[model samples]
Target: MTTRIDDTALLIARALIAALFVAGAVQKAVDPGAAQGLLAGLGLPQVLVWPALVFNALAALALLIGVAVRPVAFALAGYCAATSFFHLIPSDPWQMSIFVKNWAIAGGCLALAVAGAGRYVVTRQRKL
Candidate 1:
């Protein structure tokens, strides 16, 4: 059984992760052209722009609803890893900070992916 503190931590982590995805998706969706430019600048194919936006939006929804949490977390983690590699490999001061932040968030996503969310997640409750 999980303790209250554990539950609280999970909730906070979930919300923060969800918020990050939601914000990213919203930003991309709002300006897909910009997102495409970013992807192209990163040397990624322009075709990834729409898919990335859609994936982030869907992942955010999954996290918000605590549905398919592990898969969503895994997907987001992969995305973050790729993004970090693309943006941070150049080693600029700004990109370094973003890289650190992405890695931290990816760590949280990895925890959620492996641990299967937590006591407060819908998946946990649904199991009962």
Candidate 2:
């Protein structure tokens, strides 16, 4: 049995999920050295940080606005899974935990993609 409050719950969940990217973007903007170094360490171009930062910010806004939830959720799920590779460090429990967390976040995004944004979306799309 679902109530109107279920939509509210979805809204809150979307906001919370989006907040993860928001925080990451802000952290990168404030101190991009870490992200840049991470990229460099992985034999990737450090300049990728700019695009990643932009993507995170845009995705955060899209999620907050409840726009293109399915697409955004799917994209974020992939992003989460890809980034988890950086945290694959069994020697460091913290990094391993972060890796697990990233996978967990990806799972949440997958759920959102499957379930959709519900009635709290800012722009409603025609349901097929």
Which RMSD values do the candidates have, in order?
3.0, 3.3
Candidate 1 lDDT over residue span 1-128, tens digit each: 77788877777788889899888889887877877876788777888877887888888888876788888899889889878765665658887888888888898899988866576655443555
lDDT of 2 by residue, 1-128 (tens): 44679888888989999999999999999999999988988999999999999999999899899899999999999999999998898999999999999999999999989878878777656899
* Candidate lDDT (C-alpha), each: 0.80, 0.92
Q: Give all TM-scores, in the order shown.
A: 0.83, 0.92
The window of 10 residues in a row where model 1 has the poorest summed lDDT is: 119-128
- Candidate 1 to truth, TM: 0.83
| Model 1 residue 44 distance off true place after TM-score fit, in angstroms | 3.0
